[model samples]
Target: MTTIGIDDMALATAHHVVDLADLAAAAGVDPAKYRVGLGQDRFAFPAPDEDVVTMGAAAALPIVERHGAAGIRTLLFATESGVDQSKSAGLFVHGLLGLPPQMRVVELKQACYGGTAALQAAIGIVSRNPSERVLVVASDVARYELDSPGEPTQGAGAVAMLVAADPRLVEIEPVSGLSSAHVDDFWRPNDSSTAVVDGALSMSAYLSALTSAWDDFAAHGGAGIDEIDRFAFHQPFTKMARKALRRLATHTGAALDDVLQEATFAYNRELGNTYAASLYAGIAALLDGDDDLADRRIGLFSYGSGAVGELFTGVVRPGYDRVLRPGAVPDALAARVPLGLAEYRALHAVQHPSDVDLTTPSVTKAPFRFAGLRGRARQYERTA
Candidate 1:
């Protein structure tokens, strides 16, 4: 019987940003088609020297520096954009952050739901071993073919969380409801670099899975929809989340207020979709943006393609404000270098070749970067 939850959290986005309006103009579509219709403004795009591992390490380094990594017993990385099939991305993060070698390191893949799965596993481990600390990092680069239907949702980022007993930010309630199905709403084949998504079907699947999980959660004595002080959803886009929340509110007879939806979607609109990192990023954004959320009940709904959904609740711990700095999220967003449509396409077109002994140019300004492929192994380095 231990109280386990998120102790500290941090996030990182690529230094490059692409405005949706520019994309719309290039595609011969109205700006409102992306800004108003889809509820997205811009999204982060990783440079040639950045990928999931580099972004993941960049996010985790701040947490490790603040909390110290000596006590961490488990490091779990979740992503759909893994650099290697066999090797865990957590290992790279461990090395970059200079963590102790004694901890268990592994990667989890369940699409966007992977992060929550890792978090739940960490909670279980910490409950069994009170002294153990777990670090869960979710990072991904959502890419689709150029001019494809799913291109506008593309984004790159990471979110890292340190989980332990008596957490300073939020305490997980342990009660959760989950639903899973073998649906090919979205997936990427082994040989394909970009994902194939059934947009309409994926939206349907997301809403359906969410409803099932929420229903099960309420049946198992979870909090009522109205009773929760805040709600955060795994956001592929702001409009998608808003639609799902409205549907959930209608089904449960709860009030779907504009203020709540706006609060939850504040980060998604700015960041686009981080795939596995989206949910945690939303939570971090909420913590950083609102000062009144302290000691409030917050509900989280996580959904992944091909497809899994989970509903869980946590209480925002007292002094949560001290764990996050005000304006930190906004400042990171503001620091990105804006990319024009042509510039974005050129950057996106650069792909790593399998046979060449290539070394990536020092394109990314971040401390951690993907050095390139040397002997078919993904090489990464920490910049001095």
Candidate 2:
């Protein structure tokens, strides 16, 4: 197999935010219950003009600008927050980013694991056709019932990657540890826009899948806990990843440090859970926040509710630090307009009509936005 992996990555989130403190105060709960207990400070929320399509396009635009879209022959979009069941979300992104028409456009879904599945597929495509490039974009808006236990965990974002031979960011090893089983951890029916979650069972499933994948990886002569330099995990709440590391430490007899969790999952806390995009967002945070990752090994575990898991590793490219746009993630995060409890609640509550022309104003300042629904078709546009 030829070497293949991410050449570049970009992160984008909804421009609206709500402090977890605001959420707690509105719910008549202690602020620390969210700030410290859930390990989230603030979370990004979509404006009426933003959704997974717009976010995914915004994230991928930078990658195309740097690498050029000519070599990209595959576009894999991973998401749980899909706009339409019949149409692949990749089609909207293809036009938005102006990728070539000859590409294979696909939309993948399996909850959070969708990102990993898209990435693996991209790797396979590039490995077969080393001269071609693949664009893998994972985006989602994690929504739950208002005033529910999962409310604070809700978030919106996207992570876009350019995959090709001799990648600048990292080189993915062909081997992976995998596990899957049916579990009533989380799901959303076609009739509803929100998820139904068994929080306790979901967390248990995540840990169990990680353990199984880790053991399988070890059995296949993968790295031991001591051999790995850092880790990235699918974080629904940032605290859950800390718990996962603790479990690994106990299982492998490794002495782990507390700072490691902060390094790996701090983005999840800031951005909240992004569903299919969650794990890749963690990886983006690791790559963006840390500078000493050059030539270091990164072990990653991905778990999706209902439930599938995989453990894989990648080696950071030499001079990988130079490939990223410095201060981009932080700048995008800082630029978010803070929302009051009422504004936030009202924004989440508004439902645009899909069967007719939409009257919602185009309000997002992002490069790409959902213009409206026109003639029962979702419409998106590039902003000036």
Candidate 3:
């Protein structure tokens, strides 16, 4: 067996999440639509200068620095939020992290499912070449203009996972998934800033794709939801995760409500939905909230619209807490500066780069920043 291990995982999100209450009052939306229906209490908004590359680097730094470079041989970045169509975000991150120059690097794109795909691919590559290790990152910003129907769920962030032959985190199991082509949910046409999603239709597709993938996984592992210790779904919204769980509950003889008792509003409630990083964020939340998670088997479901989905499982290893970045989660989230409605709208309206001076001094942002936009490109600089 080609055993794969996850050495460490890290998450980082945009500092600004306009209050849902503020949004509801401004847009005349019932607060429950976001609070109960979507299970979101806060939603992140991307700064004018921030892009996926910077977010990806921020997410991975804590984990990579903790691991200390020795065996990481590849850097795989999965994102839909690329700044340049021609350049790979991995290259930018590799240079920023000062990774060894000899490492293999590539970028993967599949909407939100991009990150998990990178993780799976890295596992396979390392499994075949046991001496080699891979670094996989999934980062993106979900944008839908302020006060739009999709506004309540907007978020930005990234997660980085270092995969090796022997990981200190969860072990990636050989699993199956489904991919389908659909124009039902996506952001296309290079001119638009927001994604157009058929919300109800996308929900159906998530369930449909999960059904197909789980059928294949059941055939291979003979383990169903009843056998797994936890289920982490792509957190597009709190409600969507619950819906997917109910779909899985039907076959695995698990209670949808019971399976998601802790997941409901406890984790992503404040974080909103992070595109590629959503599932990983959920994993982090669960790990932090539960003390008895060791040795538990977790079912991870990831979906991206335009649209693809997967159902996979991993076993939480002993000492998962010790291996993970300590206190990073609470610190990152708490460090954010909450935006007022006007401040959020202004920030969200900041256009993508043009051939202009986008680089500014890092006096306003501490630790992380979009740095500046210049020459139609974004420069992400880390403050010392």
Candidate 4:
């Protein structure tokens, strides 16, 4: 069997951020509730012109530019915040990145687990056809009603991964474990822009799914918790992930060391919840912070509300550190303009109208922007 896994990865976040302190002050709450209790410091917010497709393209463009898009045989876009009800966002991303038109393009939605599902499918394809390559992108804008309990967890970003044989970043193990249940931990109806979540129920569901998936994984001869060098979970928030890890540790009777815990959540603390993109962003964060991860094993736990869970393993390839683009994530995060309470509210209020003459906001400085609607079709353009 061909060794199939991630060849390269990249991330993109909105150029604007809202500090939790500002949000707390505006809500008449203590900052520690968000910063300490939730383990979130800041969250990214999109400009008027940014959405899942644009953000997905932004994250993928760099990979296509560096590796060339000619070899790509498939493109899978995973997101719940899709712009169209009929069309797949992958088509838009393929056009935006100038990828080969002959490739298979499709979209997947199982909430946040969609990305992991795409990755797993991509690996299967590549493993069968050694010459084929697949690009999987997970992008989302997590939103909730204003002043709601889920507000601080809202964020926008994307993560793109190129999967192929002899991958440079990591080698995905063929075996994986998955658990699924029909539950309403979180859901967004077709008519609603914001998601409805039962926080306590969601947390219970997440930890339960993690435990079941891990158990199934171990039953299938997967690595034990003690043997894994790093663990990455679908991060709705940092504290949630930490709680899940603690649960895992207790289940396995393995100690969850401070370094491992810190490495798992550093990015989620700053970026908040990115929905489909969170787990991969956590992987990228671990790679960015640790220089000695090459050849190490990583345990990945992916969960999506309404609800599905997967546990998988991958081994970092030698010299995997060199595959990460220097200053990509750091530069983007550093460039973000922190928003005050009023500015944040104003930004959030700017919505895309379906039948109006919408123009690109001058404030949108991201490489890719949603260029508004034309003939009821969503349009996007690359910034000059």
Query: What's the C-alpha lDDT at position 176 in model 4?
Result: 85
TM-scores of all predicted structures: 0.97, 0.97, 0.93, 0.97
Distance (Å) between predicted and true CA of 10, model 3?
Answer: 1.1
Whole-model alpha-carbon lDDT for candidate 4: 0.88
What TM-score does candidate 1 reach? Answer: 0.97
- List, residue by residue over 1-384, the lDDT tens digit for candidate 2: 578998898999998998999889889999999988988999999988899999999999988988797878889999999999889998999998877788889999999999999999999888888999999999999999999999999999999999999999989987799999999999999978889999999999998998899899999989777778888889898988888888888777888763264666767888999988888888888887888888888888899999999999998999898887778988899999999999988888887656779855777899988888778998888887
lDDT agreement of model 2 with the native: 0.89
lDDT over C-alpha atoms for residue 283 of model 1? 89
lDDT of 3 by residue, 335-370 (tens): 777899888877778674467775564432434566
Q: Report lDDT per candidate.
A: 0.89, 0.89, 0.76, 0.88
Count of clashes in candidate 4: 0
Q: Per-residue lDDT tens digits of candidate 1, residues 1-384?
A: 678999999888997999998999889999999888888899999888888999999899889889887779899999999888899999988888888879999999999999999999999999988898999999999999999989999988999999999999999997898899999999999988899999999999999999999989988999877778888889998788788878888888778674354666677787889999999888887787777877798889999999999999999999998888677777888888899888899988887777788888897778898888878888889887
Error of 4 at 376 (Å): 0.8
